[model samples]
Target chain A: MMEELFIALWVIMSILAIAMAIHAVLSRDLIKATILMAGVSLIASFLFVLLRAPDVAMAEASIGSALTAIILVLAIRNTKRFEEGGGEK
Target chain B: MMERYDIHRSIPAILLALLVAATIFYAFVEVGFGEAKVDEEGSVSNRFISNSTQETGSSNFVTAVVVNYRGFDTLGEVTVLFLASAGMGAIVSALPAGDKRKRPIPPSLILTAGTRLVLPLIILFGSYVFVHGHLSPGGGFQGGVIIASGLLLYLVIFPEWKAPHKALALSESLAGLSFAGIGIIGLAVGGIFLDNVISGLGEAGMLVSAGLIPLIYIAIGIKVGAEMTGLVARMKGGDA
Candidate 1:
């Protein structure tokens, strides 16, 4: 049924989201962490669409993913390089 | 000379989290209690479907909800976008020009050609979305972002391409001011905010029946598109 498919997709997306969040929190490299965070946002947006809130999904895709990615890249460029095995300052 | 406690950041964050949790709990309890009352009169969903056409002229319930019932909220959302754009521009302008780097080389031929081919169609589609917001699922925000994406594509393809800053600035400012101006005009004529004064509520299901909703959406589309494009260009300059 369609409901089962929705559930499957939700589960997969939730796992990806958790993994990305953990990577973002654990990573020492600022740029890599930021990119992971962007992926988390993108997964969240997809979940929003699945939950029947397309408008919120659109906003999340535009602002949460695209704009946040650009801003984080800029931040990484401006900051000192992250230590190889330590968290970003 | 080190401070004993760094209270500024921790206290505010803890307070914000507590506030959010409390509000969520309150909303849950309120909804639980309200559901019975809601169901007493033949289900709230039916009432919504029945009354929507009468109230807003649009068959699409979501569009009606966004453009009419919550017009004030949409106004606030657009204002937030405007403020964000202005803030980004201000931050970029404050950076030292000497620290800015030279523009990067031209993008790939495919990207350049694709952008040139698609930009006009993107703009056209965005305009279509805005004009049909009252009748369909698309709205000002959707159209605005579409327009912004086209400009962003152009920026990516042509590294040296600078958005005409002065024109965009003027357009953004004027769109924002005119949106407020229309609201003020409504107050002057109808003695209330956002009251549609120019057009009478025509036959239900007509394009012109929503009074000023379509006009407001068009203004929002223009303002958001200009502001977002300006923000991207400003950030590009700052990065350079």
Candidate 2:
């Protein structure tokens, strides 16, 4: 039963990751894309936990999702916010 | 340049991507995702698994392998991180000071108050993670990033706030020096760099048992925390 729940979560998270990746690519708003990419990293960290690598999971959650997201957001803040041509606010 | 989206031009690209994805999928299935790929009795991983506790006195084998068996590689990683952050600071500083970003609306009172309350807790938790690295799953890198995240929260709320650059650089230099110094000490006393000079300090499961492992991790934690905080501060256009 426990294993069943684990597999269910694994499948769900994998699907969510794929969906988020697609959305992140399709989104023209750079900030939105960055956030969706962070969501993907968050799901990847969850998948790491499911794979029983807690250390990797922690690193992924903190560095991949949080720090990378913040860095990308700061870059966006310094530059344009949208693809092609958009003025900074 | 192709002025508009051309389906004909993209069809080949799409097919190539699908073909590459299929090949990767086939390889991944063959390897059996999430399964241990090295389980042979005489394999290096097995050797580490068998001897890690007795040799290093670290309850966490991953920690033992990373901090003891492959400590030099870890040092190289630390150096790489330091160089990357240094380069970032140099590049950002060389750029012209742009107009300051002005947020139209002030940060919410809840966020400000909540950050003030949670910052200390985040810092405490980060230190705890690094301190207990040998016994637990997290180590210096994760802990350092967590600490930086706390500072990031404050930075987000207060865009004009500046980190004390001199203090951060001093702490970072001290931490880096101590890490290398410990390795040198191990070489002097134990005939090898980063040797477990005091592996028999205490009981195996206790905090002090892993000897130089904890100390090394502490240095790494401090160095990483300072470097990451400095990186983020400089990246935010602060005078580093």
Candidate 3:
């Protein structure tokens, strides 16, 4: 029963992860893309927690999602938000 | 609103990502789950589980493995982090010198007040995490980043907030050096690097039981916190 539940969880998490990856790639604004990646990180962290790796889960939640997003957003502070070669809205 | 994306340019990247993901999926399916199979009965997992508490005096097997069995790898990881922080510092320092950008306006009163209320509690929680790493779910890297996140929030709210550069640097250096010093002590006493020597492996499951594990964790916590804070401050352009 628990194994079946875990399988369901895995499917849900993977679908969310894939959707986020697609959204990240399609997002126009750089900051929005970074946020999408952070969402992906959050999902990954959740998956880690489900796998019983609390240590990796915490690290991923804090460092991978939060700080990495902050750094990426900061790096593009002086740059244009939208992509240079026009492709998406 | 939907953005009409030109998928052609992103095709290679997408394909690469899919390839990686598929490879990972295949590997996992091939390797199978440890909990599901329990293949290595009398080998690594059993030894780590059964003897970790007795030998390393750490109830947390993860902590025991990280600080005791794989100690040198952790040191190398720390060194990599230090280099990353230093690189970040150097890059920020090279950004035109002097405060080129003016401080932005302060956040609203409610936001500031809320931040002030929560900041101390956040720090306390982070400290608890690393300090109790040997017995709990969190450890140095996790706790340190949490502390840094609190500081980051504080910085974002108060734009005029100046990071204590000298103090941060000094503490970062001290913590890193102490980690090495402890390793040296272990080498001297136990004949192996980062051995749980010098300090007695006290009663297991207790706060102060894991000998040098807690000390090492504390040092890692401080170093990681300081490094993370410095990086965030630099990225914020507070020190620029």
Which numbered prediction scores highest in lDDT against the true structure? 2
> Whose DockQ is higher: candidate 2's or candidate 3's?
3
**Residue A41 deviation, candidate 1, in Å?**
3.0
Better structure of 1 and 3 per lDDT: 3
Q: Could you give the candidate ranking by lDDT, starting with the highest?
A: 2, 3, 1
lDDT string, candidate 3, B1-240, tens digits: 577777777788889988998999988987655364435678787788888888888999999999889989999999999999899788887876444454456689999999999999999989999999999988988999999999988987887889997899999999999999999998898898898883455688888798999999999999999999999898777454
| Clash pairs for candidate 2 | none
The order of the candidates by DockQ, greatest first, is: 3, 2, 1
Q: Model 2, range B160-220, lDDT digits (tens) per residue?
A: 7889889999999999999999999999999999988999889789988889999999999
lDDT of 1 by residue, B1-240 (tens): 431233443456557756986898888875652233434577755666677776666666676677666767878988788888888788878886534444456677887888899999989988887777777667788778778877877876786786898898798788778778888888999887776675457765667766677787788888888988888878767342
Model 3, residue B99: what's the lDDT? 42
Off by over 4 Å in 2: A85-89, B1-27, B36-39
lDDT score of model 1?
0.73
Give the poorly placed runs of model 3, Cα more than 4 Å off.
A87-89, B37-41, B97-105, B198-200
Complex DockQ, candidate 2: 0.50
